[model samples]
Target: MNRKTLVLPAVIGLLAPVLAACGGTDGGSDGGGAIAVGTTDRFIATADAPAPLDPAYAYDVGSWNILRQTVQTLMIQPRGEGEPVPEAAESCTFTDTGNERYVCKLREGLKFADGNPVTAKDVKYSIDRALAIKADSGVSALLSTIDTVEAQGEREVVFHLKTADATFPYKLSTPVAGIVNPADYDKGKLRDGFEVSGSGPYKLEAKVENDEMVSAVFTKNADYKGALTVNNDKAEIRSFKDADAMDAALQNGDIDVMSRTLTPEQIKKLSIDPGENVELIDMPGLEIRYLAFNTDAPGVKDKAVRQAMAQVVNRSELVSKVYGSQAEPLYSLVPATITGHSNSFFNEYGDPSTDKAESLLAKADVTTPVKLTLHYTTDHYGAATKQEFEVLQKQLNASGLFDVTIKGTPWDSFVPAQRKGSYEVWGMGWFPDFPDADNYLAPFLDDDNFLKSPYANSVIRNTLIPASRREPDRGSAATSLTEIQDIVAEDVPVLPLWQGKQYVAARDDITGTAYVLNSSSTLQLWELGRGVSG
Candidate 1:
């Protein structure tokens, strides 16, 4: 969710006539070299929705990605493909003592965007504060095993874990671990974010809801050291509410970048050439969408009833019709591209049919029609979700086993309503905090998991996650993740539907845009510059 915003003058010397002809009399297009990026809708980071100024509260991946551009992780993940290597912190390793303590030494001369030195205490404060505020912060759950974070020296920070948590490094790599200015954070209070502060390459200039965000280069910051691929002297984030509007702005030269909303067709149409003009990249996304059956809700607690509803879902048709073949058909709760995904669910329930659904319903003694409600977010995700639910309704009705009702709330209310267990069945999607299978299983499989869907399997809850956390080996972790996936499929708390894709469309003038990292979806800002000779 990190955005690279730039505010600078652009030289429109020769394009003045062109701008005039296109009705560009406003001062938005100026002299120098600046680029404007566009997205659909507004961004609200309020006390109620409180987007934390610190990374510890960074539960929103989008928000963290934006913060990543403004700050630095102890280890920066590379933009291109490969296992993560060290970035800001020179090297990191666990202590030999059986206490399972891990330590990271900061790279010397790393300063905040405001010129304050980054120290070991800053790191300790960043993590501990998140844990301290976990009652209100969604991010505290991610650091569950962290027993204590103590500053060892001016340049070093040590983490004492409750147990052998191998994923601690990966958790630290998340934006939530982005180092903050200790001066801004209080022991247990949210900080004011209007004045921008961080050690990243860009400095915040303006952030108006649904309007635009602007940033300028932090020229004196030594931490940048040209590590970033995008160093677009300046960056701008302009919001829009619809794909068509976003498309029009890009085409009219009002926006230089796009995220999320543009469809495959829109991207194809915008690209002057498939690999050239418009940068088109389909990265392996960490997001998985499915129908969550609130097992605690009446009637759905029955395994047969859950299986019956899951059977009635025509995932193939849902992908083809709702997603226009842009998304892949998902069978396991985990998507196939992810390391641990398996086809166990597909193997068990191959296709949608009344016979299979009715058989399961009959086993549950549901001879009479079952009435169910499916909930979704109206403005979130994409337009296809509504149509996807409609198709679900039609498919379930076609089975003659259930009568269904579909409801939707705006994205804001959607989360709260679902958490209150207000829906019998609802469609939800998860974008991993980190690109790992454990993130997918641990959050959803545990009985006392977040979202409280009452979907839990003792094998997954108590056995699989603990084993994977303590395995201490990459190969073992992958195998353990796969086993957890199998157990999740068996429990049938959530039925996999389809995996989502990140689609971006750009005008022919934008270059170096194709290589942006898909995991964070944040442009390096420095890498984006004017195209080959205008």
Candidate 2:
């Protein structure tokens, strides 16, 4: 869809006043012989609490989820679609022939939860702060296309780009573009602590951090002016040591909802006998799990070794046996739902065959019995990760072509270690920042990538990606995407494993279970509420 034509110039002028005066409705019943609806605390999960709650420093999924609820962006992705619509802004347009200059007009009378007025300057300052900090895992890379951000008067903000990018609007819809109050934050430094000041649907009431476990309580923001209506007055998000503890809490009625990091077996059991207390809600598969090979490492440096591992690894078995129907085999770095995705790995290697793998190794003059180490995180992805790695170890060693050793670590250390090239081969998962093919290709294939592996292909990095981004019609970028995937399959820097199906298990009384999960796989906390039947 072409988002450039989504909003018209005249409609923006007409809607500015109406949107500013539109405040949230009174949430679920307050009590006094009525259902204790708004007063109920809705509990959810995060693998861990995001270290610094500053929008500029928060990049992980856990942090982004929290920020998405507490912060407001210029544009937002509505339920069931990837196209961004006006959120805080009344309207946004390109305003230039080259698609390099983007202009957004803020709605009238916008105010933070603290009752401070939100102006164009706060929006510009928030983005400028993110670029200034440039944290290792920060959102600076996503905003690298912007050359300048200027606030023209109170309501209008303009962005000048270094190059033409059709997908620039999608980037602004992410948490990276969350507008913060400039008076509460310094432009040069990241704001410390978990307390936040935002104008989204909810405001942070309190944050309590106890060792590795952390919890945050949110209440409906009276000053929030946006499309979303807060259904519940208060919500709680807690991080557990593992999925087991989180699931147990859900079963005992201590927590109202549970999502992410549930094992396949746990999901199956919950689905079979969910009881009258809870219900399991299944979401579309928009996430991918993969194995990344450190190309600079010793045994993994050879192309033949990487290719052999790709050939012999049984994805079908991995999905069927380990993940059950919760996931499906993925043959490309890009998931099937996205445009330009192809089964390049499957077409090149076919079904798992030991003979083909051995032949490929022999053709490259590599000696038999190649020894390799594979690393994975125990507490990061889920409880199933350990079993998944064991299954992989068994599959590779059974072929007699290689000897694999398995190592496990916690998420706290795994991320930094992997980025430092500490593992020869490792497991990783990706949840898209935005629902675009570029999100899949650019982050992993670029010269300076998130993986921090020594992989540089000038053609794919310099030519194909740039050409693809310049296309106004995303579908027309298919050819470049196909070429990029083909190059990835041949090189095998990272092997595609499977695409996951999102599951959110919540009490049956929750009214908006299905509506909470958006197309980008983010939870819209405002959509959740305890029904009157409860």
RMSD of each: 8.5, 6.9
lDDT of 2 by residue, 347-403 (tens): 888999999999999999989799988899877678888888999999999999999
Per model, how many backbone clashes are there? 30, 0
Model 2 Cα shift for residue 451 (angstroms): 1.8
Candidate 2: where are CA atoms >4 Å away?
Answer: 1-51, 210-213
Candidate 1: C-alpha lDDT:
0.64
lDDT of 1 by residue, 254-325 (tens): 776676666556754543343333445454455678888788777687788888877778888887876664
Error of 1 at 188 (Å): 1.0
Quote model 1's TM-score.
Answer: 0.85
Q: RMSD of candidate 1 to the true fold?
A: 8.5
* TM-score of each candidate structure, all chains considered together: 0.85, 0.89
